[model samples]
Target: MEETMSTRRRQFKADARQLLDRNFRFYLLLFLPIFIIMIVTAVPQWMNGAGVDNPGYNLLSLLSIISGLLTVGVSFVLIDLQRGVAELTEPVSKSFTIFNRGAYLWGAFALEIITSVFTILWSVLLLVPGIIKGLAYSQAIYIYRDYLDQGHKIGFLEAITLSRKMMDGHKWEYFVMQLSFIGWGIACVLIIPIIWVVPYMNQTMANFYVNLAAQEDESDEEPTVVSPVDDADQSTTESKPETPADGDEKTADNDDKTE
Candidate 1:
């Protein structure tokens, strides 16, 4: 039986929690540098008050963009961890794996720019549309990773386009899945809890992508359909021929009648 979206969402979170429970310390260690990086980039902006009029706002914005780009790497790390493909012994080194590959680095940069521009454009119309569009594009990085895995060198826009398609009929579900982490988000306000919360949230999100991809794979499968003509042809091919005994009996009966 096919699972409903809500059921899958719940399962994704539950599975994530189970995985985290086993490797909570490892994930916490892995997320430490990322949290620190975010704090380093954000603190100055927060202190200075980010605004158009501020002189350092542009610099801070650049830092923020860089930080966001780094998250592309973090996403891969969490995904690898979730999928059990990563080396658990070296979480810190594995976290920077995206930077070692030119494809991942540039692809992430392009995706970030393109999606941000599109989301900002949508926001021009209204806040809700922008949020919705952001949700639609949420899977772009994961889709891009999939394309790379399949050896397809797709452009960033292509990944975003595929994400929009992949997210069809599931944007609200994704949003709700995100909202399910509201308690974790609230806990992060204490700062110390952010290390654990960020990793937990990211792992759950990775699980969400896993579930979404599984559904897409299932949906892409073409069910075998038997046509009436084909079935009839098959039946005719399987029909039994007359046995030698039956042919001999018919000949003997004819001969007997003649006699």
Candidate 2:
């Protein structure tokens, strides 16, 4: 039976929860640096809330960029961990390994900028369309990673286009999947809970991508079809008996005469 979108979403979350239950401590440690980066970035914005010109704003902006780039790494790590390809022992190093590859580091940065601009542009027209576009492009980073895996480097625009294609019928399901995390989002207001919630949400999103990619791959494959005429021909060829040679016929005739 074909699984419904709701069923798949539930399964993704369930799998993520099960994985987390087994390795919550490790996952938390993995995501702790990102949480700290986010908190540090937010501090300047909070300080600037009064509209006063804060000198730290420039530094905060730099930190924000760093955070965003590191987030791409974190996403890669979580996705790898979800797919069972990443080691659990060196979570921090694995997360930073994105920086080791210039192509991935820059490609991820470019993709982030492109997707954000496009989403913001759509949002400028209306809130719903922007939200929908955001959901549609949510898988751009994952798609980029896939391209890297296949040794086919693609531009940020192309990656976004592929993500939009991959997400054609899944925007609502993805939206709802994110919406279901409202409770966790609320709990993160306490600050410390963010370490737990961040990894959980990232892992669940990774599961979502894994399932969606598998479905897309299945759909892309063409099934082999056998024609009835061809089947009949093959069956006849297999069932037909071999004709006897002249020697055999002569021997049979001789045997009959002798009998």
Candidate 3:
């Protein structure tokens, strides 16, 4: 089924619920440390006039790279965990897992740098174009996995291109979906222990990727069509008949003369 924003959110909740049913503590632990780090990272923004003011480009850049790497890391883990396809669950702590994944961790950081720089440059000229481009390039990580699995040789620009293509008609819906989380995010920051919001948001985005990827997969697949001309029965019926035997032909002639 094609998912709307609300339906995709519901689907993620349902998936999260099913996952919780397996091992709530395990899944909770999957997010706890990262949540703590998020809080830690939030401190500076809170100190800087609650993020209304800038904290200079250097600190912000480092934080962006680290945050982006961590985000992609957690996302990679959660997606694998959701499908029960990865052995990454052993680490339990997502912070450690992010780096432990080796190439995955560094690769995400690399992607983050390129995507962020490009998106920021795009935004420098115009805000709307930047936001649109931001949303467009946002799916690169998810698409990265797809390209790797499908044997598509994906470099930075190719990934961004594919992500943009996947997001062509769905950016507004996704933007609205992210906007819907604003209140919950605020509530979580206020309450602190309501850390479930992070994973929920991440999972929702992951689910969104799954939905979008499924749509792309469907689009790429050509429907199997059965042509009557190609059917075995139809071909047999249309085949040329065999010639009559000599004796049988003479008997038919005699019978016809008598008639």
Candidate 4:
């Protein structure tokens, strides 16, 4: 009992340490460049069109749409960063270099495009399918992380399935974890606190995943161990033979002699 408690405590410490050590600066770096790019393209157009009917205002709106599309793609980058931080939090930390920003960005773009089309088509019905698709696709960053290192060979559908599976039973935990950082995110409205906080939260979440992943591995390994009864069965099978033992042979000989 004491040993079990100590092991749990050690696991908690390791998880906490993993979260604390995630490289906040890297995520901040990723968030800023994309943010700056979006702002450069977006704010100017937004500011320039304060009036109701400027001819260029239509153009500005188009630009805004385009910027929004790109921003959607940027989510893939966020996902990649988040997953990277999470993978680092394992009992044994894996080294993470910055991920391929370009591929993730484009993948995000393509996904957004396809989903957008589906959403529009499904607009005839209620919005439930669209919402589910959005959540399903939300894991692209994790998908990219698993695939990018291996030369992009994994089937896209398979990656999606795996991410969804990883998220199973943990979706609520994930939602709460994201909510934990919402306060910091609100602070970013005034300044760039998100640069630090976003990465921090992402890494913290990554740590959570690591802990959960470890628990899952442990659970899987546990059932494989044989119980004492099973061990006894094996012992009996190994030691006893089906062929006539001395008592059985003597009985048979007596029966044969009698016959």
Count of backbone clashes, every candidate in sequence: 0, 0, 0, 1
Runs off by more than 4 Å, candidate 3? 1-3, 17-22, 42-64, 91-97, 100-102, 149-152, 190-192, 222-259
Tens-digit lDDT track of model 4 for 1-259:
4455346435544554454456444444444544555566666666656744344656656655555544444343333343342232221112112323566555555655654564455444646544443443445444444355334344344444444444554544445455656776788877755456544554455445444444443564321112222233443222211222333211212111100
Strongest candidate by lDDT: 2
TM-score of model 2 (CA atoms)? 0.77
Q: What lDDT does candidate 4 reach at residue 46?
A: 68
All candidates: CA RMSD (Å):
19.9, 20.2, 20.0, 19.3
Candidate 2 C-alpha lDDT tens digits along 28-107: 76777777888887766777786756788678778778777777787777776766667678766766756978888888
- Worst lDDT run of 10 residues, candidate 3, spans 250-259
Query: Compared with the true structure, what per-residue lDDT tens digits does model 3 show for residues 73-140?
Result: 77866666665555545536664556765556655667777778866876788676667777877887
Residues 219-255 of candidate 1: C-alpha lDDT, one tens digit per residue: 6432111122223334322221122232221121211
- The TM-scores of all predictions, comma-separated, are 0.75, 0.77, 0.68, 0.48
TM-score of 3: 0.68
TM-score of 4: 0.48
Best by TM-score: 2
